[model samples]
Target: MNVSVELTFTPLQNEYEPPISAFIKRVRASGFTVLENPLSTQVYGDYDGVMHMLTKEIKNSLSNIDIGLFQMKIVKTDRSSYVADF
Candidate 1:
């Protein structure tokens, strides 16, 4: 099954932009279709692949920074059906 996720990363530091930017870049580089917004980033792809990549990247990001928050809302559906185009 495919999946879609709305993810938000918050770094608990004075300088937060770099970590957030790096996280989004890693998500994009993972090959999932990424739709970035002001609040959260939406990712779409196969369930296993998306979850696996997200887990790995989030872990890597947190390990490097050591202080941050990761939030997500996941659904077992395609992006087209889950959310309408703008």
Candidate 2:
């Protein structure tokens, strides 16, 4: 099955940019479909593939920090093609 994931990583340290930027960069290099906005990141791919990559990356990211947060939302279908019409 395919899936879409939205991830907002907040590192609660004094200097927050490096970890968040590193996480996004690593996820982008993960070869999955990725979209980024100022607030969050979206990744799309097969369920297993996406989850596997996230698992590795998330662990690696959080492990390096003293405190952090990962606010994640998951959908069972890919929403990368969604175009806003208003």
Candidate 3:
């Protein structure tokens, strides 16, 4: 099944821009259709593929910073219905 998700990464550090940028880059590199906004990134793709990519990349992001927060809102639906404004 296909899925959609909104992801937010918050790094608990004084200098957080680099890590956040890197994490967004990783998400883009995963090949999923990503709509990046100021507060969150919306990803659209196959459920399994999305989950696997997120699990690996999120872990990688955390490893780099050691302390961060990952937030996600997922829905088992198509992009048009679940994600607003495409």
Q: What is the C-alpha RMSD of each candidate to the true structure, in Å?
A: 2.1, 0.6, 2.5
| Alpha-carbon TM-score of each model against the true structure | 0.89, 0.97, 0.89
Clashing pairs in 2: none
Candidate 2, residues 1-86, lDDT tens digits: the string is 98999999999999999999899999999999999999999999999999999999999999999999999999999999999998
- Clash count list over all predictions: 0, 0, 0
What TM value does model 2 have?
A: 0.97
Between candidates 1 and 2, the one scoring higher on lDDT is 2
Off by over 4 Å in 3: 80-86
Estimate candidate 3's alpha-carbon lDDT, on a 0 to 1 scale. Answer: 0.89
Residue 84 C-alpha lDDT in model 1: 61
lDDT per residue for candidate 1 within 1-86, as digits (tens), equals 88889999999989999989988998989888888889999999899999999999989889878588999999888773454658
Any residue pairs clashing in model 3, and if so which?
none
Candidate 3 C-alpha lDDT tens digits along 1-86: 98889999999999999999999998988888888889998899899999999999999899999689989999887674443656
Off by over 4 Å in 2: none
Candidate 1, poorest ten consecutive residues by summed lDDT: 76-85
Q: Write down the lDDT that model 1 would get.
A: 0.88
